[model samples]
Target: MTPNAASPLPPPAERRRLRESGSLTQDQLAKRLGIPSRTVNAWESGRTTPRGRKRKSYAALLAELSRSAAKVTVSLEKRPAAPEPAPAAAPLTPAQTFDALYAFCAPALVRQAYLLCGQRELARESVERAFQLAWQRWPEVAVDRDPAGWVRASAYEYALSPWHRFRPSHRHPEPPPPDADDRALMDVLLKLPPPYRRTLLLYDGVGLDLPETAAETEASTPATAGRLLHARETIARRLPELADPSVLHRRLAELASVERLNAPRPPAVRTGGERRSRFWTRAAIAFTVALIGTTTFTLRTAPTHYEAPVPAGVQVQGVPPRVALGPLSEAETQLRTKLRQAAAHGPERLLPVFR
Candidate 1:
């Protein structure tokens, strides 16, 4: 193809037509290209152009589309003209789109998250948080180049966050014990670095193809493949029995089985009601804090009357002239007032007292 004959990037309409001719949706094309559906949409909407590697992928996809179209044209020329195709169905609303994606993708995501974190509850939490984020940004996520990949990446990140380590983890129901070899493999897997482990899980455990794995991991295809190979080699070095591809595949299958058996059920989809409930719960907490703060400020500022102790044998004449213990020394009075304030407020508010 002449350089000028094929533009560096095809026009938006041509891209959209190519995808439609292939009977591929934006999400489908994104998955094939290891990109997000939103990227596909942006390219087709003339909002952005693919660059570098993506530009090359785009050109190749267009070429493939052209070849396929030519084949269809030749086949049609050999046969009678067909009836006109029907109009496409209307696009789904955001709610419908999210619900469809959730139903289709949540279970697999939970399993993937489980493999990453090794805790059933944490996996579920990660997937739920990811979906919640997706729901909040549905407009963008829905149009994403690979919606499932977008959510899966989010879930993976959530599972890896240091914060989850501090959260309590619920015990998962134990699966049937693994055989000796499986046990050994599990031990080795746990020792792998998180990136290698996650790549191995996505490619082998979850059965994602290299491109899909790359998209989920936010790595290029070559990078993801390298990680997978490194993980396998690492396993092989540690477990000589797995050096054989057949043995390694068997070990991977066993590991995948363990993940499937132990995977937590996907959490319920987040709804507006839950968000509202959370908002009210936060509001109640804020109100309680404000009330406590106001009460403490009032108490600290309230006047306190201090009575001086009379010394033994120090009686005065007629009415025992009231002896105000020489007004407490300036420093002592301030210290006493600060102590009261500290008691009324929290110790954290006692800078003056410490000074």
Candidate 2:
């Protein structure tokens, strides 16, 4: 036999037509397409169809398969090229990052604050206030190891602040029903020192490891580890259910929903439009106060007394052209007498100038 006898034949659309007429399976199409059976199946079933560069290869294979059959031939053409993929979006800006981060952390911070303060609205307010501060300090925080932890710490501080703690809420949201177990655990955690609370929450709650936890709290690994160990042991003794992460998660989730743990929050201090508004408000108020003071002073200190010109006509003997004092002298007894008579007779009884 010649070497050419062993050579494989070309595939063509005629092979596909014959196969379809014969009701042959995708396995036969696979032989024709020179592809795996699954890919042929995908093509035939319309799950996917080849195009672009791959279509050229498919057409060549089909042509080769057609030549071997001899009974038919069909024109081969490649499919059009596939559309290009769209470009990816740009990365988030620093301000955008802060906003996203605040949104992600608000609910958690609120739950933590609630645990500490036992007031839902106060806790929410604390978290909102904390995010407001974090937004202002985003430059310092966005790069720092644990921005979320920093925000939570700030929230805790705000929750415990004397002013915030004592202030009454005139318009408070309805108090949510308490989860007894969560409140008990939170009670224990809240009683822990700030260092322990920071360490434990970063580790057990935020899922941070020792080094990251240490960085967040500005403590050494050993110190953070120690605090975490102590905190865990304390919590475990009080609430053994925390030993299982699942239980802890369920409890936390319940708290989170109520607190809106994941809600977007504002920055701590005024920035952007808020900053401009505060500045202009203070400036306007200052200007108004200054204008009022200036007006009052001008009205108060200005000389009130003035002389009308002596009416033309009637005679004046001697009386050395009367001087026009801006106001009457206090020491002149006659002036007092003239003031009293003027008051009694509505100025008609007072002696007049020559005219």
Candidate 3:
């Protein structure tokens, strides 16, 4: 039997040709697609496939680019051909890969989580959990084309879990007393839909390039750009001071920096041993409960004896009323018999002399 070879979806050559036809570099195409430049490179190099919705979107985008290219064929004829993509980098050691990633990305991910969850502890928990998962699956993650992106996506998902919403300890942190304009901007930003808010945060707050922002938000570059634009316009209407894009970006960066600085230390990652210990602890509790239940049921169904209580004033008789006491010995019995005989015979002739 032979192993199956992995093939790129939508075909790598076609993707490259479509991108080249549009006179777009890998970075430019990545921005348009709302993904990382590395991701675009992977697609063109046949290292991976675009699946699900991404696959459909990639196909549609490629077709559109091709059509647009056809309309301007004359103008594009003089451009130089794109160079062939380089080969994939060798895989990094799991420890080195994970350590580097954690050092570089932990703070940013924590801030992102905090912004989404609005609770200090929950945000830290979300980032810790994400990193723990990445560590556990280091073999896969270390080799992944975009490990940072993978971690970011995982952290975002964890932060958005519904469990966080209902937690008793979850509470919004108090903002530093802001001036009127800052307060208004915050109010409007908080009201924006999650997608727009996240897009703006990644683009402006984190200073990610358009393509990187899209990659983080799982949106296309164009869509991410549109979201950023809309969010800015919305903010501008509420606070005219942020009307300039540069001012808004700077403000967002400052806010993100503050959040990062204020974020609590990341929670300790649970080791495999710790996770096993937790599982066993829970199992022991469950077993104890079951044992108690079975014992209680057995006791409830067991037969019991009941006795009647005596009446308050009634004297109970032990022996029958007509019955006489028995003699204590054989001699006593014989003597009593003789005495009775004598009494029967002498009843007529009884003359008594007292002594």
Candidate 4:
């Protein structure tokens, strides 16, 4: 066997099995191997045999991917059965449990958030905030069926929050990734609605199954399928070169890895959460005290009874306008002369004739 002599290819069925185990589509593997999909299809279908360095390279790549897949399987298999009430060893303390969880999930979560929002600092911030909240709710998190999922949901929410647009620091767009393909992918991703973007990333980029993706996205299975399909279609439309969704998936992973996003140490996160909680608690107590003081002061100094307040005076109304008298009437003049003679009497006035 010379360096150019390639080992016999696996049977067609085994070829498909290895590819599927690695969670790779034919187009993606073809792209990675820098060959056409039809060539890969032919090789997998047992239609052709090419004896050269290419065969050796293809077989080696497949072997590498298969080993990775196997490792993942073994790790999953090693997980303790969920129903076990107690383990042989004493249960880990809350801090240990939280730290383990944070270590396991935070790095990937930060990368995912960065892809979601395209902001490195914001992505780290979102994951930190999510872990902080998780620590505060440790009892709930500890007993959760999927603690990673809980933290992931919180991180995604924070990263994609519309309210972030109002933040002064986030007002302008951050610089895009340096590579052209990465820049294009980020632009397309940011254009998608939050739900569709999240669905696509979870299903394709994170390699989650349909049902798991649906559960994480909080959508019905059918709805999740629809979103995933539409998201692919939209991205394909925006970037015709990425019409093959397998390429899109590969590109997504590449883009996420391009940034050196990292999560803070778990201890720092835990302490930060404690400090934030304390500040809010102290603020709430101060507000309550101030409210109570104001109420007591108002009660002590308040008037004893409901004294009616005097209303402000209004201008007088109903008086007729004055008019000048031109001359005295004839009857008014005769009455005045009679009154000047001093002959007016109360008996005459009461029973006076009608003269």
Q: How well does each candidate superpose onto the true structure, as a TM-score?
A: 0.51, 0.44, 0.48, 0.64
Query: Which candidate number maximizes TM-score?
Result: 4
Error of 1 at 283 (Å): 4.0
- What are the lDDT scores of the predictions, listed in order? 0.74, 0.64, 0.71, 0.87
Arrange candidates, best lDDT first: 4, 1, 3, 2
| Pairs clashing within candidate 3 | 34-220, 34-221
Clash count for candidate 1 is 9
Which 10-residue window of candidate 4 scores lowest in summed lDDT?
1-10
Q: Write the per-residue lDDT of candidate 3 for residues 21-65, one digit (tens) a residue.
A: 788987687677776565676678776677766666777788788
**Which candidate would rank higher by TM-score, 1 or 2?**
1
**Between candidates 2 and 3, which one is better according to TM-score?**
3
Q: Residue-wise lDDT of candidate 2 within 127-244, one digit each (tens)?
A: 7777766665667988878687788778877776657534466245445447676557667866888678767665655555567778767889898889978887787788897866
- Evaluation by lDDT, superior candidate among 3 and 4: 4
lDDT of 4 by residue, 312-355 (tens): 99978998878877888999999989877875566557544896
What's every prediction's RMSD, in angstroms?
20.9, 23.1, 15.3, 12.5
Model 1 lDDT-worst window of ten: 259-268
lDDT-wise, the better of 2 and 3 is: 3
Q: Name the TM-score of candidate 4.
A: 0.64
Best by lDDT: 4
C-alpha lDDT of candidate 1 relative to the true structure: 0.74
